[model samples]
Target: MIEISLTPIRRYWLASLVLLLLPVAGYAEDSVWKPVPLGDAASWPAWRGPLGDGVSQAKNLPTHWSSSENLAWKTSLNGWGDSTPAVVGDHIFLTLQNEANELRLLRLDANTGQIERNILVDTAETPREAPQRSSQKFHNLHNMASPSPVVSGDYVVVHFGNGLLATYTLEGEEVWRHNLQSEYGEYSIWWGHANSPVIFKGMVISVCMQDSLADLRQEPIESYVVAHDLKTGKVRWFTPRMPDGSAEELDAYTTPLLVQKDGQTQIVIMGGNALDAYDPYTGKQLWHLPNLVGGRTVTGPVLGDGNIFTTRGMRKPLLAVKLADFRGEVPAEAIEWTVEKTTPDTPSPVFANGMLFTVTDDGIANCYDAKTGQQHWRERLGGNFKASPVVADGKIYFLNLDGKCTVVAVKPKYEEIAVNEINDTTIASPAIANGKLFIRGKNALYCIGK
Candidate 1:
């Protein structure tokens, strides 16, 4: 034992040094792969394109694409989902669920449509046992991954209906995972939650809506806008809604919109019976617009021209309110206008060039004056539209569930510019990024561009 050599000790020290530096080297490589942001108006990084308004600033986006024509590339997805694709830099990210309710995240090379990585994020612990309702009834679109993904830089965030929220690196390594369903979320309404997560600053915001069950004596079921630290999956703050204790009115399936007005950043959330605003940084409620009738909300709110526009009720009215000041309760007079009949129950509205444009779930596109509530034009594009419309290059692209996209000129007068069809059914909305359009169908993802 006294003959231990110094050479062996030196060899061990060198091996330890290399092991210690390996992680640092990998981190440095990751930091260099920052995504190239779409600087122009045509690219969309998240749901409904840029600004979360479904309006594209891009001009000259390809209007016609088929299986062989105008298509940049088409890739067959491994799993099925109703979620849209998110493009950031050279990669596109989306979520899908297997027949067994096992959720997966996929990353593809945006230019080539080659799948870079497919990672299994979460698995449903138990099989769905409930009886399937008829087509007339609204319930969880079983096995359909309906939540869209949000991407910033190299980090991609996704929410699965099973209450799983996860983040991944550009290389497809899972960074963080959280089970909102098991922790604080419960299935309440007929349709499972369909709200897409929105990113603000460094946090990811999601709406967790669950109704209180009498049998469980659940704590007053509350809907909340929760901000989580992007890197750690830790809840930063939770802004709770005023509980109504009514099971039918306790759900919110709307994504929160982050907007900047009058030098203040606000998070706007719409739910069963109210539209509310909060400070994005601290989760403090700034204002609440109450008395909204109880009905499941699907579309989130949109902000434009210093006002916030929201739709409520499964078959109700659309409301537009001006947010000129933020210190107190907004006066009733602040409501600019309300529109009844033909308001969308699923897709959100789009604002472009001083006009408000929305497509009804039945395929009617309505345009209104942005400053006033005056109706400008209403036209039937002729297909049911569950996906939202995107405006790019002064043109509006409306993707319908029947797989037809009606492109129209975004003017006060209605003008159908072009009609393109892909033959595949789609429930997810389209995304525009890097001069290309991304559409998620029932079984595939398509990239269309010039």
Candidate 2:
């Protein structure tokens, strides 16, 4: 969606749609095109795409699109969210919160961009923004639906800043719903909660990095990560994480990254003044690197070349942690490098074609060698950037907040492809599937293809 307007990470702990062995409910059988399974490489089932990275396996995705050119379908959305649309089979799902604060799960027909169903899962009487925050309202730029939905097999999990978590079938039948505030306590974040859920091994996982309630109440104001059963929405396991940082330094809006290397799987989570790897199956901490103690973190972390590059939150040093022999406390040698200047605060960096690309919130773009951190290129693209780039067809598409997309080649030297613009302002990242690119803006959803 590209609205000339307002706006809004997530876990890579996901299951392949093929692993979703349960059949989609019969309501979708009448479709002429077979729905793509939620776990297929070609489907955009979670934040950043199926592999949990920004790069898309899609070939021949549209390189050109505007308000009226190469437009396949355009559907108007009722509310605002900064979440990327999740595509599975022939349906697209996005969470929306209207002015009334009703969080809705909307399913649309992929081929025609026609509305299929809109299910109201939950509603919050107060604004999505926290009460402690002033001059901020959820309806203006973003709301509880900022966290993108995760589609795994037979279930689609949707979460919101207001603590609502619900599951629905592919056909939009309600399965189960719960609230984090009810399970835990009131939210203590300064702004709002936007951590999205990740699905893995039949469990949907989520985490929160919030402020301590030591000043507000007696009950422990703890931060933790937990997983729920996909079928029953029952708690599988919960692990409390107490970072040593104080106040706002503990706030984290980053979504978890599922990294697998050397035959082992770990959930890479950053927040509360540290970066830690946890076992997805048992909710156990595998390793941690602490003392980051920076401001609130927004940029989701990325992985490549045996390293994980992460923004230390709030324009702090962008640290590269090497994972060759990481165990317990991270060794000093594990930090390959730290790039302090011109790091992104909101947008996550992308690693592609032996290069690392980062765009600051103010729109400064930098490219570095993935292994040695050698500067490849640095240039300003103009405008504010919050949406992460989409990599495909040997090109990276960088989107600004004003809805301008600057396409650049992925090579040692930077080469501009084309700059395209739409009618709306946008903050949600783009998704690619079935040879088409799906973009969500302030008020509408646009599909671009040849």
Candidate 3:
């Protein structure tokens, strides 16, 4: 090897160059496959919130807000989606179909109700295929743009019922896009698919729990859980999710919940007549409890007290299955409690404090003991609730399809705090972030808070 001796000035210049190169090398290493932070604790980074559970940790949140009082701002949007808004930092991300009938993602100024960026997410490369209008019978309340968007740090992921799943940066640059149906097969479900995308650690997770492939003439089709690299959108791993149900019962628009209990973390999905758990990092089927037998599950499960509260499809039973004790060989003894009456057929159950609160598709609201499943109270608030109830400041806020929000006390006893109203129609759930409520309606997006 030949060595060159340098002068003092030359040596100093070389040292500076080397120092700059070190950080570049380190950044390249850290940039690839790194865990994306979920962002501000007060931010609604996902469909439900930062915890992936439909509960927020915000305290002193507004208990009462009306159209004229405590009204922040109301901004008009192009089209509507049943999907909830995802808020990160100053931007609120929502998935919508523009007037041109193109699926899109909208970013709005969170402080003021103003459109910041409108990114067309569904392009020819990621085409949004509407099921034949003759058979594309979605529930009267939903459409193709129903799945909510989830955000984590610099990345925000949006999904549409038409199978377009795209990820973008907070600055509105496309990171990667994939059509779930294109890669798998055409989705043939009774109603359109509306399962939202979720994020865990270094990956963005998606679940397509639909009808059996044989039934759709796509013999190999199966429900699947997929995890992708947060930065590059590379498929980290794909796992086949086999839920046992028949025909119409096979379709599940339910989102998976990430539960960490008893020093063990697992992704819990409720669908196809069963509640199962999978290893989130590797997508391994860890342990599963079968025989739930509830079909077309819309209610996502919630966790509390070493047990998870789940609604078995629709109009069946609200069950609390003990998870901490059972591992393998799950049998009939796993389910600890069941409320078999007035369970919701559409809206999901929200677990907050020590109560499992649920509202039916019509108007009935029931509060049950989270552990025992004993009915605390059954009350009718009188509007049609499609949005899941949210809890904050010792009150539960339930928004109905008529744009009315009924605030209830968190006790076992039924107490109505306030019945606030908005004029627009909505099927989208309300999102809580930074001490404010973001509710997307058919005609507008309302930012309501004190």
Name the best candidate (by TM-score). 2
Which residue runs of candidate 1 sit more than 4 Å off their true CA positions?
1-43, 125-144, 212-218, 243-245
Clashing residue pairs, backbone N/CA/C < 3 A, model 3: none
Candidate 3 deviant stretches above 4 angstroms = 1-39, 123-137, 213-220
Report the Cα lDDT for residue 276, model 3: 84
* Per-residue lDDT of candidate 2, residues 95-121 (tens digit): 988888788899999999999999888
Please, what are the lDDT tens digits per residue for candidate 3 over residues 1-450?
111111232555445434323222223322321112345768888777776666676787776777778889999988777989998778999988766777888999999978989988874222234454212356657777889988887788888877788889888999898888789766767677889878888688899877674544545467889998888878999998876666667677888888663234578888888888888889988767777886678888777655777778867778877654234435555567677678898888887778889999998998887867777888888878789888776888889999988899999999998888889997888899988888889999998878
Q: What number of clashing residue pairs does each candidate have, in the order they appear?
A: 7, 17, 0
Give the higher-lDDT candidate: 1 or 2: 2
Model 1: per-residue Cα lDDT over 1-450, one tens digit each: 011111222555445434433232223222321111222344466776557777665557798888888899889876677787877778888888877667888888999999988888888632344443211123544353678888876678889777788888778888888877577655554566667888877788887654544344546545667888888888999776664435555566777777763245777778867777788889988776677774767777877776787776574677787653343344344456777677898888888788889889998889988776678888889888888787788898899987899989889998888899987888888888888888888878888988
| Candidate 2 segments exceeding 4 Å error | 1-38, 126-140, 215-220
Error of 3 at 91 (Å): 1.3
Q: Which candidate model has the greater TM-score, 1 or 2? A: 2
Best by lDDT: 2
